[model samples]
Every structure is written in structure tokens, then in C-alpha cells.
Target: MGFLNAVGNVGLALSVAQVATASFYIYLEWYAHGKWTGHPGMQEMKKIAENISSSSFSTASTSSDELEFLRSHPSPEGVASSIDKEFRRMEKFVAFAGRGLTSSWSGRRIVVTPSWILFSHRTTFLPICQLLGHLGAVVVGTRCINNQIASLGEDEEQERADPMLGSGVVMATIRIADMDSGACMLSFDLPASELENFRLYLCCPLVYAQGVSLEPSIIQRFLEAFSAVVQENEPIEIPPSMELERCIGCLSNQTSVAIRRSCAGECGSCRCRPMWCEMCVGRWFASRLAQSHVPTSEWVASRVPCPTCRSLFCVRDVISLKRAQY
Candidate 1:
């Protein structure tokens, strides 16, 4: 009986050790992947880790046989498979829940909505630690990469004098949002001045690119602690579209003022209008149409009949309706 009891104690210790080993490997996998792939893969791994945590607890609690099996069979491949499956499930959840959360958070939560798309040029680390120090965004994540901004030259300064060019400053794309809600604000031609804090103060190359949406609570907290290195609010100068001749709406003498949804579809352009304007909707349609079997000629015609909808409309009309509120 004494020997049998000793064997049971050893089995329990082995089970505990197996759990610890699995956790360590999982952590290593996530740490390695996060640096390579950025936040999306990290988030996916977090979801996987949560699943493993639950499974470990449940197996230890209810089923000793299952726990023993995992310990004896000990397959790293099995652990990896489990992680991948959980990520697939998260992708499905995002597909349905992403849009609504993005919109709601942007409208209600963002305190100071930036008009620039922010990108970090550093390719080494997830901006989480820095962002958490600067702003605690829960849903949105930022990555840092190394990129050099060019110094302004005489020729570039000359172009700035032209009304078409507006300012000598080069525009940047930036994304800012509440982390939890997934609501994001994208500014394509944001002023270089707004990023002064990150560029000069943070001593990191920042630019614009795609990023994960974070929850608002996380962002709010992050900003609260973020050091305000630059206090000067330079009024940004935005240039008019010079592509007027090639644009159907501009050629047709429609409203030259183009209102678009930067992140929250809350503005009149996104909410009141039945469809998105040619500016907002056409770009996406053009890419999708290019890949599809649709004829190029059909896209340029002013009042071509849409084979898909059987509706008669001009080039401008179709583009507008294509982006209309659905």
C-alpha cells in the first residue's frame, strides 16, 4: 500500500510538470511569432493561450485519465494544432464583430481624434510596451519600423508655393483608435508636425500602415500617461485633389468637397448618405473589379447599364450608388 501511494504522488508531480512544460513552449512560440508577424498573430496566440489555460484547469479538475494521456503522449504538434484552431475561430468572430465595434468606439470614446495616419518605422518590437506607456489602447496595436524621412529641398519648397501643393510638408498616413472597440481613424495626409512627439522625442521612425483596432479603454489609459512632448497645435493644411480631370464626379461638376469615412461611419458622408461617394467606394471597387472578369470599358462609361444590377447610370452615378448606404 505504501509503494502504491508513492507511485500516485509521483504521477501527480509529473502531471504538474507537464502542464508547466506545455505553458513554457506555448509562451516561447507566441514570443517568437509576435516579433515576426506583429500584433495580429500575437492576439491570435493570446486567444490560444486562454484556451489552453482553460483546458489545463478542466482536465486537472475533472479527468485525471485525460491529463495522464496528454502527459504520456506529450506532443508539441498537438499543442500547436490547438493554437491554430483557436486563431481560426477568432478570425470568424472578427469577421462579424469587427465593424460594429470599430464604429461605436470611434464615435463615443476617442477624446482627441488625430487627423493623421500613424505608422512606426521600427521593425523590431511590438509597440505595445511603448503604446502602453504612451496610451493604453486595448483593441488597436502599433508596430515600429525603421524608415527615414527626407529633408525638404529647394525644388520641393517651390512646389509648396503652388495652390495644388498647399504646403512644403510631406503628408503621412496615420491610424488612431480606441483599442477595445476596434474603431479606427485613418488620415492619409496627416501633418508631419502632429508626429513630432514620436519622431523627435521618441526617437523612432513613425509612418502609416495597417494596424489592429484596439479597445477604447486601453487607448484612453495609454494617452493619459503618454508624455505630451509637443504642445503646439499646428493647423494642418490639406490640398485639393489635382486628379480633377480624370475624376468623373469632378468632371461632372458635382460637389468638389468630398466627405469620407476615416474610421467611424458617423459623419454625414457615412451615415446620412445611402451610398459612399466615388472617393470612398470607388477605390475598393476598382481593386476588386480589376481582379474580376468585368470589362474595363464598362467602368468608364458615363451611363452604362450595370449587368449585375440591370440599372442605368453614369460613371459617376454608378460609383456613388456602388458605395451607397446598404
Candidate 2:
């Protein structure tokens, strides 16, 4: 074969390989988390919350834990208590970090607290966020494509089921959501030049929250692929801005009437704003509550300085982030 032809074949092969690898990652992620068919685990969790017949609580406070109220609660109340307790525990350390992190059960949108985003910038963590954001965008985008293809008026068997065809886009979407949601965890210390210190936390959608860990290979490959895409295609950036119309510190921590009543801002209660990523924050709360440390109002009040400009903005201002679209 001619040299130029050989080079063309190699480029095509690499492109095909990239797509295939991306697809495999998505399928495995969906399969592991049981998200392919509308999140069976989350559905079960919801069912457990609704099940009045069960005497045994799906999530209950242990006797050793100091929070005895949760121990005394019934199954439904106990589960809600569990979510609140654990969420507080995991986020307690993070409460003082920055503003804009939100957790709202009423609206079903856990926004990345502005504090966390600003902290990333303060600590020079934008690259990490960007990488994760790109990953989320690709993954979600791929899912969108697959869903589109499946809906194209063809029989399920006849239409292509192969995720490889649109996997790159899927992975990209997932990364974007990860960054946007603020569930993308980064190493505490990374060199100024290298953003290799990031790993998707359990809060990430594709990874199982119950079984999450730092595995560098896949994340690295995804980053490299995404970078190449940007270098080659030069796509336009979609400026995103969050509108936080209310005080971040004023939000009710739990959706429960009892918890909200007890902890509402009017009651001299400090509210824990929602984390940018609700699912991630929910899982974080669940994990922490299992250990038993209710988040406090004071801890949530302390705010971190912005990483970029080092400006101190109120939680409300942080929530309402406005950026130029161009």
C-alpha cells in the first residue's frame, strides 16, 4: 500500500479504537451502576422510602451512634434521617470550603456549591474540573445519541445497539456533568503544570457510589482523547451560568418537614446548601450519615475564598454565577 494510504488507514483505525474504548467504558459504567434501565438501585431506594410495611429500616441509626433521634424514628423517617446524617458527615469537612454548593430536595437539583468551584480555581484546580466536565459531557452526549438512534422509528432488533458508534460523545458528556456537578474529586496537591491528580469520585454518575475508587487508566485515556478532539475540531464553548436567587446558607438541609422545621434559618439554624451534584451529594451524605455526625449550621457558615480572584462572595452570590456566553 502507498505510504499516504497506510497513514490514512492507521488514522481511521485509531479513531475507531477511540470510539470502541469509549463505548465499552460507558456500557460497563451503566451496567455496574444499574443505570442502563433507569437506575434500578435508586428506584429500589425510592421504593424503600415508600414502603410502609417494612419494620426493618433500609437505613437506620445504630445504638452506638450519638444521634438517638434517628434511632427512635420509624422506617421512612429513619431513612430520611439516615440521608441527612450521613450527608452532613461527609460534607461537614467540606462546608467551610467555598460557596455555591447546594442541596435541594424540593427542586431535585444538587448544584455544585460555588465554594467548591471557587476553591478549585483558588487552588489552581480548573484543569481538573475542565477534564471532568468534558468527560461528563461526552458520556451524557453519547447516551443522548443512543437514545436518539433507538427512537428513530425502527425495530429495537434492527437498529444498532452497539454503543461504540457514539461512545466518545457519551464519555464526553459524563465528564462534563461530573465537572458541572462538582462531584469530580481532585488530588489535594498537584503540580501547576499537570492536572493528572484527578479521579472521579463516587458522586460521578457512571461510577457506582457504593463501589467507587481511583482508577487512573480509564480517566487518563478519556482526558487524552478529549484533548485531542479539542485540538483537532476546535469546537465552540457553551458558556454556562448558574442563577442562585436565594441565599446559599438559607436553604433547608433536609426535605423532611421535621428536619427543616428544626433546622430552618428562622430557627437560628444554619442551613447546608445543596451540593452542585445532587446524586453525588446524596451519596456523600448517605456515606457520612452511616458513620453518624449531623452537619452543623456553624460549619456550613464558614466560607472559603475564591481560588481565582480570591474574592469573598456570599453563598447567594456564589449560587448566581454569571459568565459571558462568548
Candidate 3:
């Protein structure tokens, strides 16, 4: 039954892909033929273009009359508006494709695109996948978790047996799978709160697969494991002892004495030496959050890992360091 369902989903996806590809090519050809050149909005655009061309040929600044004309014309703004409208249309087509593909599958749905399509149009495809990913959808060619089953505990079993018990009760089976690898990563029956973090982690690419949940402590462990893996695969380079005294993030000699005291023993008792200033670390944290595809608002509460040691630290920790006195 599962094999049949999978085959059906593949056929549906192929059909949707064909429709989308045809629509995109048709629109491109139409656009190339200047079908929209005679649009009613073009009259104002033509006037603006004439004014701009004339301005380019003249050395003297335009008079107040010309400035007013330019302001009223807003040719550049009009062009941008048209481009935005077309982009929205394309976005709608992609959304429609995603929805149609998802509805054809049972259980958790995953949308798989040909590797050629992904490589050729990654910029367009990534955003669409990201949108679907946020809504509990999975995209192919990335790590994901899928169909996990967990056994119910005795108390939970009794709750399920009770006819009076309502839908408020959490289920025993918690399934999570990696869509890219097409393998189930977690299947244990954990609390829903704990499970929520795993879901969030899967949707974002900042963290790698570690066969664990997303609690701060658990994430720290994952980072440590990741660091070990990275270290094993790469050659190690020992920094000079003098360089170690400066901030690793900014290479600044100015260190915050107060932060060192406050965060004492927080970074683990590694005698390897602490080499980051408060301000530098703060900036580094901000940069990581900015680089992440996950929405900033969503990650504001998340902890950041150290660039040097992969030790997980919170924004508050970095902020405190930033405000620390000598």
C-alpha cells in the first residue's frame, strides 16, 4: 500500500512540474515578445524615459519644472512595481505547484524535484521550499526526518483506553524523518514540547543531523559532536600563543575583564584559553543569525555556538559581555 502511494505521489509531482515548467516558459516567451509594452502604464514611462534621456545629454541641472515633472512621473518606481507584480505571479504558480503535489500524498508529504531542476534554479526553488518547510512540508535534496513510531507508556495507554478522555491527550508515536536521506531519524515517544524543537531544527540548516532533539543542552552536545567530525575531516592548525591572547572573532587585543569574571567556568574548564571579546562575540552571534535562513524572530530565543570551540552560548551571555566593565 505504501509503495503504491509513493508511486502515485511521484506521478502527481511530475504532472505539476510539467504544468509549472510550461507556464514559466510561456510567460517568458510572451514577455520577450513585448506583449506588455503597450500597457496603459507605459505612456507615463515613455515620458519619464524621454526626460531622463534629455537630462543625460545636458550638463546643467534641470529647472524646478523639470524636477517636478520627474517627481510626478516616477518612472523607476513604476518599473519596479511592474517587476514586483510579475514576481508575485511567479510565486503564486510555485505555491500552487507545491500545494497540488502535497495533497496527492498521504501521511507526511515530501516534494522531490529533479537534481537538474534544483541545481539550475536553486535561487527560485529554495525560497519556495523554505515556505513549504515552515508549514510542516519537506523538500528533497536536504536533510529531513520522517515516519517514526513510539510505544505508549502505561499511563498514556490507560488514557487512550478511557472513552471519556478527549483529544487533548498527546499521542504515543512521534515520527520524524530526514526527507533528503529518506530515513527516519527519531521514533521515540517523547513529550510534545521536546518534539517541537526537533521539528524546528529540521526546518533550519544552521544545525546538522546529530540524531537528537533541539534543547539547548542537547544542541550543545550536537555541536560538540559536529566539531569532532569537522576536526577529524580537516587538518588542524595550532595558532601562535601570542595570537591566542587576542579575540578570535575580531583579532582585537582589547579584552573585557568583567565578562571573563562573570562567565567564569561557563565555557567549560578547558585550559585551552578564552580568546574572544564581548563585543566581537556579540557581532559574531548577530552575523550567524543573519546568515541563517530561519526567520530572525524565530531564532532570537535560540543560543549561538562559539566559532572557535562550538560551545553554545545565549544572546544574553554575549550582551552581558558587551556591557561588562574593565
Candidate 4:
């Protein structure tokens, strides 16, 4: 009985130690960012928000750590006001949108003032904001290829396309490190479009003054594959008898794309009429691939399902609809 009690006590202690160690490391990551609220597990939270592609923020808060740091010097309010004005004019993005976890999609929003680079998120209460003054390096998070373009249930044809094909930028993660310590301070994922704005806004020697080189992200070269594949097929013209309707996806634009199964793959015959715009349909296809954790580069080469009918289709099937002339 004494030996058994000793073994059990030791096992309990080890288990408690492991749990404490894990919780400590988790808290450290959050502390490194700031005293922010709502702590979600980093890796788990990333999976939930990984597909959010686009810019999201342009405003600043007076309570930010940067403001306090700036105030430590002379003429605090003056500096803060100037920074605030510039930040407002800069437009915001949906980078890790709080509402996005439930619904809605948005992307990269990083504001650069003279003294600091502001990173903010849309939270329930005061937006969880942070500031980084150090200039370090940036790196991408992730890529692929195409082969047997198979429709749903065509396992033999779906050989996981060439992993090397396409620009290979699925969900690009931009890792921003600190200059002083060379430690990663902030890192987030952004879609292809928002990356353009990121490079443009920070085009200066200071960003790379520490001899930093950036990792390749969702550059246009990678996106050109998607565009090329999408453009490979011609648009399908609608007859005068068929009336165009608002897109079900956006509910704003007229339905301009039709999914008439034209791919050589064994795609199911979709009888549904055109009810989606080209952009919405394309985005929907991309989102489907992303949500499935598939490689972004194999997008055009891969087959997808019709947004409405669930019938399998490929990029070639997405035909832009044009009204017939009288």
C-alpha cells in the first residue's frame, strides 16, 4: 500500500507540472503581445481564422502602449494627436476580424506612423491593439501542382495534383520579428490582395535596415496561375429569354457566371441556372478549397463543387454570362 501510494503521488505531481508548464508558455505568448483580453490558443485560433483574406483597421486608441511610450518623452498629447489623425486617414482592414469567427471575411490592416507600426484587431469591447517600433524581418507562412482533375468520388483521378505546381501561396503567413531581440513579435495570415498593400506601405530602407530579407508570400506570380486557369475557358452567353438575377452570394451584383459542366473530368451535370457572379463564384470556390485545407496553388487545376447545387465543377466550368443582344 505504501509503494502504490508513492507511485500515485509521483504521477499526480508530474501531471500537474506538465499542465502548469503548458499554461505558462501559453500565457507568455499572450504577454509578449500585450495585456489584451480574450486569450485563444494560438494554433487553434489560427485554424479558425486562417482563411480570412483582406485588410481590416486604420484607427488608433489613446490607451495603446505606444502612446504611453511616446508620452514618456516630451510633448505627449501633440504626438499622439498627430499619430491619431494620420491613422484615421489610412483606412482599416479586417485582419483577424472578431466578427469573422462567426461570419464575414476580412484581411490585413497594419498602420505605420512615424514612431510605430500599429497592429489592431476588431474585438467585442475596445479593440485589442498593439504597437511594434522595432524593424525586423518578415516571412511567409506557406504552396503546388496539378494532374488528374477528378470530380467528387473520382479517387483515382484525384492523385493530389503536383505539389510543386502554381505560385503555391495558399494562406500566406507574414511573420514580423523584433529588431532589438530578433524575436517574432507579431505574425498573421493575409490573402494575396492584402499583401500588395503591405509591401507598398512599408517600402523604405528602415524596414530592411537590419539587413532583413522577407519570405515570399502570395505574390502575383502565384496568383497568375489562378487567373490563367480561370481565363482558359470562354464565357457562356445567355439567351434573351433568360433574365439575369442578383447574385445569391453577394445579393448585390447581377448573376454573371454560369456553371455549365464543361470540364473533361467526370463532373456531374448541373441543372441549376446561373445565380452567381463571376467574382463571388470564384471567391466561393477558393474559400471552399481553403476551408478544406487544400493547397492554394492547385486551385485552377483542382475541381470544385457548384455553390448552389453541390454538383462538382472546375474553373473551366465557371462561364461569365452575357445577355444576348436584341
**Top lDDT prediction, candidate number:** 4
Model 3 stretches with alpha carbons more than 4 Å out: 1-244, 257-272, 298-300, 319-326
Q: Whose TM-score is greatest here? A: 4
Q: Among all windows of ten consecutive residues in candidate 2, which has the lowest summed lDDT?
A: 97-106
Worst 10 residues of 3 by lDDT: 114-123
Worst 10 contiguous positions by lDDT, candidate 1: 90-99
Clashing residue pair totals per candidate (backbone < 3 A): 46, 50, 10, 19
Count clashing pairs, candidate 2: 50
lDDT of 4 by residue, 163-191 (tens): 33233323334556645677765654444
Q: What is the lDDT of candidate 4?
A: 0.50
Off by over 4 Å in 4: 1-227
Cα lDDT tens digits, model 1, 109-209, are 11121111122222211111111111222212332212332322321311122232233433333444433454542322223322322221121124334
What is the lDDT, from 0 to 100, of the residue 188 in candidate 4?
A: 49
Candidate 3 residue 139 Cα shift, in angstroms, is 39
How well does candidate 4 score on lDDT at residue 82?
A: 41
